[model samples]
Target: MTSRRPLSFWIKWLLLIALVLGIALGVTRALGKRKATSEAARATAESLQKTPTYTLSSTDVVTVQSIELTQTVALSGSVDALQTAAIKARTAGEIQGLSKREGDPVKAGEVVARIDSTEAQARVRQTARQAESAQAQVAIAKRTFDNNQALVRQGFISSTALDTATANLSSAEATHQAALAALDIARKSLADTTLRSPLTGQISARLVQNGERVAIDTRVFDVVDLTGFELEAAIAPADAVAVKVGQTARLTVEGLSEPVQATVARINPSVQAASRSVLVYLRVPALPGMRQGLFAQGHIVIGGVTALAVPVSAVRNDKPQPYVQVVREGAVVHVPLQPGATGLKGTEPMRAVEGLPAGTQLLRAQAGLIREGTAVRLSAPATVSN
Candidate 1:
């Protein structure tokens, strides 16, 4: 400090000091700006994370309720007529007069078709002629026997001759009886050539056409009574035990818009050997447009119980334990469920569950999956006008 220095040197030193201070100030301001930016980014990230991710509608959630749950067993099968008959050819002959086709109405004992009766008629005529000839021979033999008896009484003929005449008369009578029986059989064959409907119903099929030769017991047509119908459904042996006659069912029949009502009419006493299933017959009322062979599927209500339940779809199995997503305190909460008996509430399937109180609102199947601790906002339910 005592040494004399040039003014330029001092100016240079002062300028260097000023440059270092400027750099320090610039660095401090840059660090403060970077810290403020980082804090703002963190705040934005937290806000986004805390915000509600899903806004659910009223229909998206289902409320747990104490309901009378109807336990049911699923079934599917074909619809069959309660009364059906296969019209078969009773005699072997050429088919004729078969005017009835499928869907044609037929009454009881109505002649639906006929076979050619030429051979049958000829047989009948031949047997009848034989019977007449035998009858004539019987008359002649009887007259001879009477004459022989008189001659024996007068001592003109031996008793052996009278016995011979009596034997001849008996033989003639037996021949006549045999001829009569043959004639009756031929007549019956002729009658059988005409096919008759066994029941009052509509024709379901025409297996033969006119002029087609058919053998005895050949299926010619199928007749079905459409006044009522039944469904033959095979059920599991475990479920079949609870099934009983007179239980109600609702069936969705193929090609029919409205659900058909059915009743459990009969259950098979024995299990099917091949499938190890039990056959259950459900009686369905005949309605407009009902037809045989229609596919049907439904459930048989076996029993009912009053319990806390939720929709069957509400139960989720994504985790190791079965659980249902519940809404509580405006957040998604997963409640572990001990699923009990499954049943139906009206037409919707509901499942009985424990570990949840009645009136707990739950996320439906349509709500998809929401993360745990995620916020949710449910729309207000619609108000009904009085």
Candidate 2:
């Protein structure tokens, strides 16, 4: 520092110091930028790690339980009267004094219609007069026969004459017997003009009108007993075996607001050839507004038993075999089930399932988004109401 240097030497020394300082400053700035970039990258990575993953919520979960399940078989049919009778004209004549029409209520032995009885009554009277004349002749014949017997014994007349008188008396008695029989026939024919109902029911149809000529065996009316109603349903052979006499049924008619109760009365012994189904007859009580020919559907209770049951909606059949979605350890598990007897769950339908422990949670409805091993959040467990 004390020695004086040349001007060029001094300049060169100052330039070298400037270059060294510039390099040091540039290196410091670069290091600072690198440190900031690394810190920002670390912060972003930590934020991503702290965030939670998305999951699905399961709402239709049902807990499997041991309950009393009533098995049922579904059936359909038309409502029909237990008794239907067709009224026919018994005698051939013009319809007269017609008293009943369609929808008219009738009682047993009530006169429904009357035919013209002018000819019938005249025939009866004529036959009766003839019978009276024949009876007088028979009385005269008896007296003549008695007198002839006394004459033959007293020899007042020849035996041959007595025999001729006996023959005449016999002939007169035969004529009298024939006239009486003819009178009886005419009286019965006259009474046949009046048509009476054999049963107490309502007239369903009136085939003949007043003053219309009809022949014997003509269908004059159709009567149906509405007090006792029955449903005749056809059941498939597979289900027919389960149905039995005395089983209760619930019927739903198109016009009725509530289901009608009925009991299984009988079953046809032979299967129908065309439908390959068995016919089941069910007895129904007379309701306020039930009529004939109303279509109805029903279910017969086959039996009642305790079983591990689930709602029919809960069971799925997407796979080759039927399966159910179960929630286990907060994950969806697909369980294959061996389904058993199908039944009702208090008006709702249910099916019996095996190979699952009681109290296992199952899905009430199928979820398209849920699959095996998928994590789920469970809501409240479903409970069946009585």
Candidate 3:
């Protein structure tokens, strides 16, 4: 009624109204699409919730069986001669000759090497002559004492003179004894010049050569008794408490094809400062071709205990808490477990688990896929090997 004259103005108003109506229709269509999508998703979820689970057969399960779990402590060590002798020169002398060389088999009391015994021999002879002179002096003193005694009884000499003679005889006897002891010492020094092996073994090294002058306590040879071997194994202090004398171990040497058996000979009381381990000495069986200084590794079986366990394949660890799937009364049950040790069972890996009783049926393979309340058929379960 105010200004209906301009047709352009009327067209503009009509356009504006059409644009608003279009926007409203678009928004309504968008809302309808969103509602339809939400309804479809809800329907799909309900259908999935109502779907029946598939049943797994007993063949797909592993029965948790009673197993003998042998606990072992790992050990590493080196091979050594059971008895080793470090030969040294007791007396200083020139190495005139060596009777044995490296790898030479020696016997107890054997002369392995000889020093320059010429000086020693000369000293021994001189000592012997002195000893002989001392003996002569003692004999003469004894004669003088006897003569003085007879003279004193016959009144030929005074009592004081007799006493003087006795005193002289005692002095002579003491001097003779001193000379004899000196001679004995000289003889010992002479014997020491000839180096002798205290034990029967093979010479592992020769430190001195002929014509070489050596001082006292100088190393001459290294002899090792190859008849038997020893293993010095270092074990953790915690496990070493269980180790005792006479406990046996199976050892593997570097070159040996089969494991050698050894008996625990000794155990160190104090822990090693650097390694924080205890030293355990084991005596290895003396077999052919066994040598010293070879590296070895072994295990000490502590004891065996019965435990309910399953193969390692049955345990699933993908979740925050490790668990295993078990089939009970025709339904799958999710069981969270406290797993103990792995690699306890022979060749095949097995796991020690708690919170599960014996005869529990666990899935044989891929237990992670199992869900709670899933249906399962009770068929004959597969036996867990060990």
Candidate 4:
């Protein structure tokens, strides 16, 4: 037993190596479990933070639709008649009778007034008697000249006597021609006793009363043709150039319930020095009760064409380009559109844009208050009647 009991150094070394291996294996297992747990906890915290929350309020959106809109113009103007005449007298006489009073309708060639013509009547009769006397004298001269020729051929009268008779006959013929012309003049004077209307019109004014003495070329009646009336307006220097003959325009009176159509008729070439404006004439479409100088406001159509349009407030220039805010599912969408001509003053009905459906609701109120994706409430529906 003493001989076998000699201890081996190799066995002791083997036992030391085994103990070190066992401790290493135990440390590795514990560290692996702790690292995995840390990774799982980190992933769980990151997931909670990634969830998104919506806090903005929302409003319903609408779509754009098309409608027919009437183009209108408003301008200052006065009413005028197309055919206005200052009826005047051609001859001087006393007013004997008035056939037409103010506001009476008259026909062409109808007598409008009568003059006291007692002298004219006497002159006509006197001229007629003188003409008859001249005619009888011409007949006497003709017989005398015939007799003188007969006598000269028969040699019964002296040549000097025949010459004298011929001379007297020529003088009598000249006087008869003068008397005929005088009769014609007297006849015309008699006819001038009645003043007649040259054209069919309404009597607008009367200058002389019955039994009043009037002078030649005196104004007796004023006639006006109301059928051809017009509206006269002063157009600004900026808008005057666009108006032309035959252009369509609209006329609205303060008391009228409906608008009236009109056509461009004339433009004053002379510019007004004070206002730098031109006078424009618009022929009113056949309408009722259009009197002289009725106050009217007309929209002279400066231009025309169908283009894109949107609310005037909807247009915004954020970066030199006009853009509109579109709200979608609580998200803000910026939409930019091409703008057309600057329109007339009013609540701008529509502006030009792209990528919008026919009925998409757009934000129009408090224009500047809207931003990309900002929640909006339509104070009133952004609806436009075409």
lDDT of 4 by residue, 317-368 (tens): 7667777666566445777777555443332345545566666665544544
Candidate 3 stretches with Cα past 4 Å from truth are 1-64, 268-278, 310-343, 347-351, 356-386
Each prediction's RMSD to truth: 5.1, 9.2, 6.2, 15.4
TM-score of 3: 0.73
What is candidate 3's lDDT per residue for 1-386, written digit by digit as tens? 69567898889999999999999999999999999999999999999788686555545778787787766667887899978998899888898668787889999899888888888888889888888898898899899999999999999889998898899899888988888898898899999998888899999999878989999999999999888888888888888987888877777788889888888899988899999999999888878778889898877767666777778777777789888887778778888888486435654457788878887777877434767887766545555546
- Indicate the residue-level lDDT of 345 in model 1: 80
Error of model 3, residue 129, in angstroms? 1.1
**Per-residue lDDT of candidate 1, residues 135-185 (tens digit):** 999999999999999999999989999999999999999999999999999
Better of 2 and 3 by lDDT: 2
Per-model CA lDDT versus the true structure: 0.91, 0.86, 0.82, 0.72
TM-score of each: 0.83, 0.74, 0.73, 0.58
* 1-386 per-residue lDDT for model 2 (tens digits): 69887899989999999999999999999999999999999999998676553243444667888888888889998999988988788889999777788899999899898989999999999999999999999899889888989999998998898788889899999999999999999999998998888899999999989989999999898999999999999999999998889999998987999999999999999999999999999998889889999899979999888888888887787889988888788778898888498888778788887887888887667445366876667545455411
- At residue 137, what lDDT does model 4 achieve? 89
Query: Ten consecutive residues with minimal summed lDDT in candidate 3?
Result: 341-350
Best by lDDT: 1
Error of 2 at 274 (Å): 5.4
The candidate 4 region of ten consecutive residues with least summed lDDT is: 53-62
TM-score of candidate 4 relative to the true fold:
0.58
